[model samples]
Target chain A: MSSTAGSTLTHQETDLHLQGVINRPYQVVVWNDPVNLMSYVAWVFRSYFGHSKEKARELMLQVHHRGKAVVSSGAREKMERHVTAMHNYGLQATLEEAE
Target chain B: MARAFRATTRGYKADLESHERRLLSQLCADVITMLETRGKQLTGDDAPAGTDAEDDYAHFRRELAGLGDQIDGSDAAGGLAPPDDAALARLLPDASSDPQEAAQFRRLSESSLRESKLADLRAARMALEGEPVSLTEEQAPVFGRALNDVRLTLASRLGVEDEADAEQIHQMAKAGSAATTEALMAELYAFSTWLQETLFSAMLDVMPEDD
Candidate 1:
């Protein structure tokens, strides 16, 4: 489906397409928890994932209001690492094959 | 009286009274002990014989090597079960919804995760030992992590699984510092919540505006 953006692809993006076609991608999903403070969740998004202040707050709000949010998406191995990192930060995060 | 955390030019600062600091320190220690107990269960080591700093390093290396073997499937019990204790389970949660995948993930990474959390908790303990409970920029997240663990532990005990429970806890906390065990827990939980809110607010303020 991403085939329409072909010409603008960098060499790395082209390589990513090749890999993505071969391997299904995964998403890191962070779930809502009342115990984790809102500010702490937003700070984690900004600090750990390097999301912008706006992006972090948005994702944090999504997790808060929507009960869960996809914080990141990538190869399975990379997403697994992020899952572990989130656990270390005391966040309830899980990984699954992206639909 | 204790002051909430605030951002400083150097890093972050919170003025905690002696009792407050001591209470937080004890909470960190409690979580560390719980994790260490889980660590022992994961590695199947009852008591490490390491007596001193040097010996402990070697002991740690050996255990890590054992964990490496477990990950490689050399050990039959590599796929370990999650912690039965609810509080411990909350701190170290399942990484996948699928049971098999979660077990495999836990087998591969739980020990290291537990160790890293223990390290953070220990560092936070030292940070709390100071009069003002100051954290350098480098130590801010580390301290924040340890503080978060304490909050998680308290939350687990408080049964704060949903917003309703949290609201009930808020009301309980307002019932004075200690009328009952649950009330005491609620107060401590609320205090930790306020402390963490201030710390992360300061941290977020200092962050670069964009990714």
Candidate 2:
């Protein structure tokens, strides 16, 4: 599904094709929880995932507004690890196969 | 008691009175016990033993099936398993959307997670009991984690959903019309949140700046 005007393959199109060929990634989704503070969630994102402060806040806001947000996507093992870590930190998180 | 935590040469320090130390230790101990109990339940360690051969065989078959499902990552025909209590639910969230996958993940990781939580609580309790209460840089994170857990438990009990709820609790407590349990829990929740925030800031102060 190329949206670009150019007939030649675009970088975005190529990346999508590569992702289709490779093993499908699994995503770790963090859900909004009443007990966890927004600032704390942002801090966890920054500290655990090495995300920058701005990016962490952006993800945290998405979780707040959207009920949940995909915080990380990768191999099944890594996603499982990330979900466990989130649970340890007392955040509501779940893993799902990425579409 | 007064806010006791502060930055220190070693890492972080808190000078709590004997009673305060006892209270903190007791809270941590309670958390440890609850987590251990829940862990046992999750792993089916608390399953009742069967006296008859047929019953024993059935139990064995059930355990074998569970192990097989965990290995294959099959979805158990159900929604998420409900938490034993609100506090436990807050402490341990589901790790996967699929019911079976979540059960498998819980079986694999719940023990280690419980152990780490227990270790953190015990570390905090030990520091509270030690002469000249202090936590080294390494130990401070453990204490922080324990504090976070306590706050989560208290907040869950208090039904603290957002800032507005917290503010209302404080106002009700101040008005002297609130129930004793609600007032006391709200106070504890606020205190724990303050302590956690202070300790976290102290820990951050000691960290080396990025190049």
Candidate 3:
């Protein structure tokens, strides 16, 4: 009986692990575009996402230099909403399945 | 006449002469018209049958049709596609790398997004149309967004890619050369940027110090 209970607990743990694997977090990536000003991008990061000015500048520089930067990561729905908001603010953005 | 925007106890206030107000109203009206035209074009109706615009829409539709395997069924809304124009593309960027996901994002949000911009433009126009061009607290953000959109459009058209480019344009404008289209656009871009900055500063004045 004890052996059966232990096996059941192990199965539940495996199920949870599989669920975690299947539901990996999604990331919102802001892509650098020539049209948007660097100052404007930093301001959007600071104001919209409420990041610190320094942090915003760091992220903006990442985007400018690397062509893109993952600004936030979370559940797929939240990431989608973030991408949409970024679009509304005239910034190029996308969602990616997190690595 | 030098007119600057300032934050008032009531909201944000800008003192402008009648002609200046009239010109601003006209500009807002023009932007609204442009946004509406773009919105129609997105739905694949405004473009003629065999034009590039229509072709682009067809491609988008085909991409969307093939997206069933990638995206969830509930995310597909089937609205307009992305714009081909650089200015419109800047204003409404794709929200996803995947064409299917981007199309779904556009379908679900583009109309409302366009409407919000239109609403902002309208609010600014209405405020200017009044005797006193003052924006309420709620209306201030709308005006600010409208100004930003106008500036974005102008900057895109002027090809102001970076600070250096914008600075050169500013110098050209300051030299008082309206002889070229680039010079004229630069002047307009500078004016719009100044106006937007003024409004933003006014809003900043009203914010808490900690912010």
TM-score (all chains, Cα) for each model: 0.83, 0.74, 0.74
Candidate 2 lDDT by residue in tens digits, B52-90: 464345445545655333212222542234354778777
The lDDT per prediction is 0.84, 0.71, 0.72
- Candidate 1 i-RMS: 0.8
DockQ value of candidate 3: 0.31
For model 1, residues B106-192, the per-residue Cα lDDT tens digits are 888888899999999999999989989899999999998888999899888888889899989988888776878888888888898
Q: Which ranking of candidates, highest lDDT first?
A: 1, 3, 2
iRMSD, per candidate, in listed order: 0.8, 2.4, 3.1
User: lDDT score, residue B205, model 1?
Assistant: 79
lDDT of 3 by residue, B96-170 (tens): 667766777777787788887788888888888865678887787677677777777877788777767778877
How do the residues A1-99 of candidate 3 rate in per-residue lDDT, one tens digit apiece?
A: 012333444655667665566567889999876545565676678777888767888999999998899899988878878887776666778888898
Specify the highest-lDDT model's number.
1
Please report, as a residue range, the 10-residue window in candidate 1 chain B with the lowest summed lDDT: B67-76
Error of 3 at B133 (Å): 3.0
Candidate 2: which pairs clash? none
Stretches of candidate 3 exceeding 4 Å from the true structure: A1-16, A31-47, A52-69, B44-81, B209-211
Classify candidate 1 by CAPRI docking class: medium
